[model samples]
Target: MSEILTITTDEVVPDREAVFEHQGIPAGRAVAAEIEALCTAAMEVFRQAAAPAGVLAEISKADFATLYKGDGQNEDATPVDEIYPRAKHLALFAVTVGEEVSRRIADGFKSKDFVDACMLDSVASASAERAVEIVQQRFLERATARSPAATKGEHRRLAGVPTGETPVPQFSSRAEKILDISSTGGDRRSPVDGVLAYSPGYCGWDISGQRKLFEFLKPETVGISLGESCLMQPLKSVSGVFIIGPKAIHLFDNCYSFCGRCTTHNCRDRIRALDAGG
Candidate 1:
């Protein structure tokens, strides 16, 4: 079963700078009064129409194996292959700002209101991202709460573990099962202490993986759906697993065969942000 995550408009107010950047305008650039008015209007629509909500389900390490496949056998090893094995816990999640915002954006475009359509689209996109970020933070908080020591200010120091082998924060018998299932069983170095969300179609993980992910998550209860092309509907929705492991597991150079054809190296920025504790 999955848990429903409720969020408010205040939690995911679209960032003004992000909206401008999404619309191809640099942040802080002088804007015409009319454009500013349109931006304000877009924000109002987002505030009224947005219904940010999410659903997340914790999966056993065993289930993640089949869900992490690519197009075919012998496919290139993706970043997920390297990073997921080290995870102490994994949760599949999906978040969206909801369908009303999407409907309004479509209505704008249908009436040939390109400026309004673009503005609303940008705001909706930013709002959806913010919703996803909020969900991730909440999940991390719940994870921390599960660790009794973390609640008492002993987050960094494990009780009986040796100095170099300090287990990951919130380590449990479940983690031992994860270690046994993973190839890293015999290695006693503790799991890493960071949480990061990763999605399909990035870092060599095939977009086709979305089918399996959606099957397990069944985000339809939260009004998110997957398309035949493996794209999530509502266009602004984000879906993926929150991999809880060491920071080093997520570090990787984009040297895969697929990297040469890629245009956006967004993973570099994401990894850097993770390292910076963002």
Candidate 2:
């Protein structure tokens, strides 16, 4: 189906606070105990102060030959293939944490409570990230089951398990069964095949890109809107496109490699932390 597909779900707001591996909260990488205490307290407040905000999404893949086909993929094409090689499909998607979190932050700012504001920020970030995960999980399950990957035969690393690996298995009865099923032609289809997610104002994709995403996703169906500056209105919200092919791993792992493309240096640390995250 060439038409865009939409997904919606009520995600249980993740019950945790955002933490950085090298944050200088009280000081550089403050004691985990102290941070945990702070996070626990903040999360307690957030639990009541906020409610589960869901996710909204739109996903579609277009022919690479059009707006995104790299260079040599087509003989008439130019040098883009060198920059982004072997990209078979462009998967565009946008997901957002809902409006209630925004209400919490606005209320915090109104009272001039920085601590509360920061806690809310952590919760909002967690919620937004969760929103994307929820949407992706749903989309992938739906997409792969009905996608070409399922019907069209493609070479994928088939399910396999080696025998006599003491570290993993000691050639037990299960190992014999495993080796038997480890054939050359097996399907490992996934909607998130080497996905390279690009959010508006993120990963070198300019904030201005949100207009295109918004127009495509119509995120307003789930109460998401963009501000005049192209930032998603919920503040904690995120939007992006995905490149789902093997060549996209590098961008998916470190999107900031294209940092030079964006002029806004405001969120470098935050973006870096997210990229470095496991």
Candidate 3:
């Protein structure tokens, strides 16, 4: 079964910079007032048109062994025993702003509404960003409040998001949650203070790897689908495997966020500085 959740999509609060970035506006033409006005109007469309949604599924530890092995994850160990070393429980997630965002994008292009298309593009990206954060926040709260306290479990990163803008050699999580190299070693542990996301594609699992994720997720319950190529259909959707446990933490040098690549200040959570934008 899937657990559905809500997230804010009110007033996109247009970030002119993000709009320009999305529009591929040249740096030389950035100061154009005409473009700015267009972006502002697009933001209004997002507020009125976008509807963000979040859904999650609970996978017990019992199926871990069979799941990884059958997925052809086998390399050295029996696959399952190799990838999923420890801990309990798994949460599969998918978040989207629905087809309305795309419909708006199509309508914009058809009517010569460049700003509408571009800003709606920004909204699609922005909605996916916020929806996932809300879902992760909710997951962490639940994982931490349980009887044993989620923080106590040593984290074992089987899969999740890249820790930062720069790629690390190992397990990925939010940069702040990532530890220094000195802490790197066997079974690294940290307080289960937050939830981290991972997908098949992140840790080298490609479209083929997603089969296990979808089979286990049964995303249809939440209106998500893996296309013939394994990409999410809505195009604006986000999917990942997440869990809360100390061992889930991965070590790295100077952990950075993927947001480091973005120069836009449009996102509410946009890390203004390149340094530790947690």
Which residue pairs does candidate 2 place in steric collision?
A: 71-81, 198-240, 199-239
TM-score leader: 1
lDDT of 1 by residue, 1-278 (tens): 78898889899987788888888887789888898899999999889998888999988888988787734432377777877876667899999998898999999999999999899999999888888788887876677567421211122222222334535443333323322222223554333355789888776677888888888999999889999998988877999999765454555568877778878798776765663452
Q: Could you say which candidate leads in lDDT? A: 1
Residues 1-278 of candidate 2: C-alpha lDDT, one tens digit per residue:
22333433335355542333212243354456755776666555555654333333433344322333322122232223232444434444555545666777788888887766666677667666666665555554455455443111121111122322221233223322222222234453231333334454444444565666666557565566877877776666666544333321222222345644546453433323322221
- lDDT per residue (tens digit) for residues 117-224 in model 3: 866787567567667767776776676666353332122222233322332434324433343212344565433333456555443334455667778767665566
Worst 10 residues of 1 by lDDT: 149-158
Q: List the residue pairs that clash in candidate 1.
A: 192-246
Model 1 lDDT, residue 1, Cα: 70
lDDT of each: 0.74, 0.45, 0.55
Q: Which model, 1 or 3, shows the larger TM-score?
A: 1
> For candidate 2, what is the TM-score?
0.57
lDDT value, residue 105 of candidate 1: 94
lDDT of 2: 0.45
Candidate 3 overall lDDT versus native: 0.55
